[model samples]
Target: MIVGGQLVDEPSATSPGTFVSVDNGVPLSATNPAGSGDWTGWSITRSLIDGLPALFARNAATGALY
Candidate 1:
């Protein structure tokens, strides 16, 4: 897999990534399903990781927050 534009050498290893967004006070509603919520589009500017293999965080000190 690829992370940070570099190839991950460990076949049994894992990588983590995140998605972020900012609230603009705009409401996004689903009419058919009757859903309502504000749309906070993904904040790419604040994303630390992007376009990487699927993973999750578990600890802060170790950079994992699962």
Candidate 2:
């Protein structure tokens, strides 16, 4: 899981090195799935949006939530 814009492993996450978006706010073009190619993220820093800290990304292929 990518929490707070930093990759983190969930307590019961069965798969490793996998990530998905917990919220549906992320756009379709913003994602880079791991299996699609590799090296999905870079300079993934957290930024403020509408005076709120928000960071969103995901692999639409997974269709699973952690």
Candidate 3:
């Protein structure tokens, strides 16, 4: 579980989860799963500086943008 964009781990198994903010400290997406194995669905995005073009990539698992 995420809270504020940083990974967190606890010992008692009752502590809150961690958060991960994306896009330069911007909140992009969030997820809360019941079980774990291979959390799929993600995407990616490339940005341009001045005149260059940006490229965006998406995957089949998490649908996350990078």
Candidate 4:
């Protein structure tokens, strides 16, 4: 998937190579009702935001882009 003209991918539940992956629209936080590390429906991208390289992701379930 793509966000803000940047390229993204949902290759697997957890990152194929590194880091944490949360489910689409599923909140991953200390106080999340669904707990943590349980959601994995996210579209992730490594790109430039505000002219700086950053990692971006979208929550498929909630339409949250961050």
Among these predicted structures, which one has the highest TM-score? 4
Question: Which tens-of-lDDT digit does each residue in 1-66 have in candidate 1?
Answer: 223322223322143552222222222331211122211221112233576554432222233232
Candidate 3 wrongly placed segments (more than 4 Å)? 1-24, 30-40, 47-55, 61-66
For model 2, residues 1-66, the per-residue Cα lDDT tens digits are 443434443343357844443453333333343435432443333569999986644444554221
- Give per-residue lDDT, candidate 1, residue 21: 22
RMSD of each: 16.1, 12.8, 12.5, 10.9
Ranking by lDDT: 4, 2, 3, 1
**Which tens-of-lDDT digit does each residue in 1-66 have in candidate 4?**
443333334345464665334334232332222333333565666887899989765667887776
Given candidate 3, what's the lDDT at residue 59? Answer: 46
Name the Cα RMSD for model 1: 16.1
Give the poorly placed runs of model 4, Cα more than 4 Å off. Answer: 1-39
Model 2 lDDT-worst window of ten: 24-33
Worst 10 residues of 3 by lDDT: 1-10
* Number of backbone-clashing residue pairs for each candidate, in the order shown: 9, 0, 20, 8
Q: Per the 3 Å backbone cut-off, how many clashing residue pairs does candidate 3 have?
A: 20
Residue pair clashes in candidate 4: 22-39, 23-39, 23-40, 23-41, 24-41, 24-61, 25-61, 25-62
In terms of lDDT, the poorest run of 10 residues in model 1 is 37-46
TM-scores, all candidates, are 0.16, 0.25, 0.24, 0.36
Q: On residues 1-66, what C-alpha lDDT tens digit does candidate 3 reach at each position? A: 122532223233244553333332433334323233222343334588797977554545555444
| Best of the two (2, 4) by lDDT | 4
